[model samples]
Target: MAPVVTGVIDAHVHLWNRATDPQPWIDPTTMAAIDRDFTPGDLERMLDSAGVDAAVVVQASNSAAETRRLLAHPSPRIAGVVGWTDLTADVAAQLDGLDPASRRRLVGIRHLVHIDPDPDWLARPDVGRALDQLGARDLGFDLVVRWWQLPLAATVVAAHPGVRFVVDHLGGIAESDDEAGWEAGWEAGLRELACRPNTFAKISGLAGLVNGGDGARLRRVVDVALDAFGPERLMYGSDWPLAELGAGAVAWRRAVDELVGELSPAERQSIMSGAASVLYGLGG
Candidate 1:
């Protein structure tokens, strides 16, 4: 009933307690949809209903302490974590600060690069060195940038061939009818980033972009991404809690099922779980 070919391993998910997590971006004055708290209990119930076997809990706030808390969170379904740190600062110190036992929980690192004031933040020498440190520890780097940042993102990811750079949210393509404005550039940038063997893309966040099951637009975008990165390099993710901002949990899951149902069984499994296993070092 939930369109399950096999167990899915969601590669991007967030669980935060707003009262304690200090999510600066979630202002009740405006963004009310995601202003509430969501914890591991909620995560487990949702993932189980969706038939997901495992997941990677990602950071919503830029707090190092929050990352530690996530690493320490006792969710068995959470197979991995993509934490946050001040990339411009001492990256090694941040990684070293983690307890050895908890450190194994880390699967990748992500910064809210979409909100960074400096457009060239990814290209900065300090950030580059920080990414180097991140990759050296065998963790992947999640590139969550805006659409305009894709070109520079490609360049930065290319510069770090050793790092497993994963582009989230279809390389940050926003939902729009501006075919004349963003279509060409997004396609080119996606292809460019896909050319790098070290780079992977997540077929998530589209629920927040498309109008319901926007078959035409979703088809085009996903087709381009699949063509460029292929199924092996792409992974599935449900940007939960935040997905409430666009399509709520149940609806978005159905949307993903409808869209990805186009793929072969093996391809679907790759997006749902296979890539997540290898890239994040999840269950073998």
Candidate 2:
């Protein structure tokens, strides 16, 4: 029997205000559901309804100002912030510039590497140095990369064993015309990445991958993640407003609940909250 899930911690959620951080990637035509600003209040309501106790608010844009704003948010339900920092810059100084309270709220840093023109950005020497600084401070680095970039991410993860790495959105799997080919490549790359002991993955941002939210496809990806990282290195995330574009938050949450329902109580807890708590340093 599936154990009763006592709590849930969404490891990846994004909040954006267009006035400060313009999400240029969002198109009103296609992503009309989430084109508007998503504030802390909106997030709190969603979490409450989903029964999620807390969430790690991730950066939606590559803006330092946005990061500071997110860190300063007064929402007690926001467990931590995965803010942005320029990978090519002096990451240490940038982090040091933050106030003590903001620094404490920051659990990790991320960059929209998937959209960057340079595919080899993660392999640059300067980026490596910046990642080293994050490791030294005991902070995590969230890798939001395309399926093709998974190997590169794995290489970087292996190099920075000291830094806790969390792969966002199951390596950003999306709907592809060549479904079989896409799954094969994604599975291979994800499995290789899972070999890195310091790496973890989020079962988020996946409900939208398929046209109709195919239950079988979702299960397959989750199972692959389970086989690769296991429950200890896997965490749940609503991916929120973006999820609204797909199955909607409530539906996605229900889907995830059903997907992980077969695991033992301890294993289910790990995926639901334990993994996120440990990875993001969220105190009980």
Q: Who wins the lDDT comparison? A: 2
lDDT agreement of model 2 with the native: 0.87
Which consecutive 10 residues in model 2 have the weakest lDDT in total? 1-10
lDDT (10s digit) by residue, model 2, range 79-175: 8899999979888788889878667889899998998898899999999999989888878999999888898998899898899999999997756
Q: Can you give the TM-score per candidate against the true fold? A: 0.92, 0.95
lDDT (10s digit) by residue, model 1, range 56-88: 888987789889999998777878889998899
Give lDDT per model, in order: 0.83, 0.87
TM-score of 1: 0.92
